[model samples]
Every structure is written in structure tokens, then in C-alpha cells.
Target: MIELRNVSKRFADLVVLDGVDFSVRKGETVALLGPSGVGKSVLLKHINGLIHPDKGEVWVDGQNLTRLKRKELARLRSRIGYVFQYGALFDSMTVEDNIKLGITDEASAADETYSRKRALQCLELVNLDPVVAEKYPAELSGGMKKRVGIARAIAGQPTYLLWDEPTSGLDPVNADIIDSLVEKLDDELGVTSVVVTHDVRGAFRVADRIAMLMDGRIRAMGSPAELRASTDAAVQEFLERDLTIPVHH
Candidate 1:
């Protein structure tokens, strides 16, 4: 499980996360939902020890990330998988090579045949043709590239998966496809997932529970129906995308 206790962050003059608390349980899928600048991505970073909080703690599986040194952080990070918004793949490398990057040595490099076969199997999980394994990222469509990225993220079979805006740049159909795939990963593989998304509709469809952030704090955390029926104006405004009503600064 992942836990954040009174975590806070600031960017020089601006405070991004202020005394925020949220957690992702084992086998649970939690969506961080909020406006674009509410530090949703920052919260995701804390889970993987990408960024330490200014104060308080981020604990994953009983390990307090802030207490860990750099080397320990690396070990903690290796257990987690991440899929970024842009599906950052090496344009020069083939899809197979990209996924192979995640594979640990001795397992992946046991022999040339073993490595290639494992990489291909990971690609198959994302529903990509084995033929495309040799293709470069530039050759794949946006959705395919995203799938390949997901394939790569799971190549090492991480216990925790963090998705940073999975459906950001895809069409509705493709976005839904990705959403289904995420749900499949959790259900089939039992991988714990924490997805940070500004897309409310997408979040509702994919998330087991949603945590809404505003003013650098978690304003609400509940199931989709619970969040929709919330009495808080902030929650209502965020779900409704109320641009006309100005929130106090």
C-alpha cells in the first residue's frame, strides 16, 4: 500500500500541495482528480520517491520514502511502474528494445532467445502484434505507442503502477481502449494502480475511487457516485467544471 501523511510541497512562491493526505491500498485503483495545476502529478511523484515532500512523509509498503537515501530510493522505485503522458519511448529503438529496457538482467539476458521471447510476450499483453516488435516508436500510432509504453511499464511486473494522465492525447475511442486496458491490468494481474487525471469522465469510468485535489489539499476522496453527490461546492464545481463561479484564492 501507498500512504501520504500531511505531505506538503512548494515551488518557490507557490505552494502546490499543502498538508495533503491520501492512500492507495493493495489491489485498489485510485484516481487523483483535480484541475491541471492542483499538484496531481506531484502527488504521483511522491509515491515513487521522484520528489520528496517539503514536510511530512510518503510511505510505500511501510517504507518512509523521505527517510530513505538515494540508493534506497532507487530500490523502492524499481518495484513501481510508471506510464507517462507522452509515452516516452526511444524513437531510435524498436518496440521490443523499449520493453526490454525494463527487464532485469539475468532474467532478460539469460540468453538471446529467452530475452527476445520475454519481450515479445510483454508486447502481446498490450494486444500488439509481434511483428511490430521490430518497429520504432515513430512508426506506431499515438495509441499504439501508448500501448507499447504500457507494455514496457509492465515488462518487469511491478507491484505498483502509476499512470500520469493515460488518456490525455487520445480520441474518445482510443481513450476508452486505454481505460479498459488499465482496468484489465488491475483485475487480471492484480497490480495496484494510482492514476492522476484531470479528465473527470475518464476517471469516473476507470477509477475504483477518486481523490479530488484543490488548493493544495485533498478536498474529497470517495467512490464515483459518492463524489458526484457531494455537497461541497469545491467538489461540485470541479466535477461540473464550473468556470463561471470563481473560487477564492
Candidate 2:
């Protein structure tokens, strides 16, 4: 489980997250929804201790992230997987090498045979052919690179997964494919997940619950049907605008 208690953050003078409270239960997928640059990604980073809140605590799996020592935090982080928005694959490294970097265990990573086998297995988990493991990042299309990023994140078989805009730059067809992949992964891996996305249709399809962030706070959060029936004007406005986009299937 992950919990943030009255979290707040600011950059220079601009406040991003203000008095925000959020939590994710074990074995459930929650979608963090908001417009671009609304600090959804920042909030996600706090779960892994990448960003610290000014006046609140972030607790994960019965441990407070802010109080954990460096080594202790690293140990906890090994149980979490983060998929960056831009894919973040090294242009210089082959796909296999990138995936191997996620093998966090020192002993397992040192074993050449294990690393190789795990990389191939991760590729398969993301529905990519093992042949693609030998290709460079530049050789693959946008969707393929995103899959490689997800494959890399799951290489360690983490208990928790954080995805930042997994389908942001893709076309609608590819976006739907990625959404389906997100659902497949959650069911197959049984990993708790937080997916930050502006895509309403994707969130509705994939998340067990949805939380909408606006004006540095969670304006509303509930199931898809509940959100659709929300009385809050902000939630209605945001949903009306995003839902205008044609949702294929």
C-alpha cells in the first residue's frame, strides 16, 4: 500500500501539490488523472522517494519513505518499478542491455546467463518478440520503445509500478494498445499500479478507481461510473472536455 498524508510541494514560488492526500491499496490499479503539467508526475515520484514533500509523510508498505535512510530507501525502491513518460531508453544501449539494467539484485545481475534470460523474459511479458531485444532504440517505432521501457521497469518483478503518461505521444490506435497492455500487465503480474495520464478513456478502461488532480489538489476520486455522475462542476467540465475525443471501442 502507498499513502501520502497532506503532502505539499513547490518550485521556487510556484506551488504544485498543496495539501494533497492520496493512497493506493495493495493489488489495485489506480489512475491519477490531470491535465499536463499539473504535478501528477511529481506526486508519482514521491511514492519512490524521488521527490520529497515539504510537510507530509509518504508511506509505502508500512514504511515511511521520508524517514528511511539512503540504503534503506534503495532497498525499498528495488521493489518498485517506474516507467518514465519519454521511454527513457538509452539511445546508445541495445534493448536487452536496457532491460538488464532493471535487474536490481547484485547477485542475479552479476550472473551473465541470468541477466540474459531475464531480459528475454521481460520482453516477452511486454508482448514484444525476443528478436527485438537485439535491436537498438533507434531501430524501433514509438510504440515499441514504450514497450521496451515497460519491459525494463518490470525486469525486477516489482510489487509496485508507477507509470507516467505511458501513452502520451502515441496515436489513438497505439494508445488503445498500450491501455490494453496496462490491463493485461496488472492482471498477469498482480502488481499494484499508479498510472498518471490525461487520457480519460484509457483511465476509465484500465483503472479500478480514478483520482483527478486540479488546482494542486485532488478535486474528485471514485469509480468510473461515480466520476461520470459526480456533482462537482470541475470534474464535469474536465471530463466533458476530454471525453469529446472519440474513444475507439
Best by lDDT: 2
Q: Over the stretch 3-30, how does candidate 1's per-residue lDDT look in tens digits?
A: 9999999999999999999998898999
- Model 1 gets an lDDT of 0.86
Each candidate's lDDT (Cα)? 0.86, 0.93
RMSD of 2: 1.6
In model 1, the runs with Cα more than 4 Å from the true position are 109-111, 241-249
The stretch of ten residues in a row with the least summed lDDT in candidate 2 is 240-249
Q: For all candidates, what are the clash counts?
A: 0, 0
- Candidate 2 residue-wise lDDT at 57: 90
**Model 1 TM-score (2 dp):** 0.92
Clashing pairs for predicted structure model 1, backbone only: none
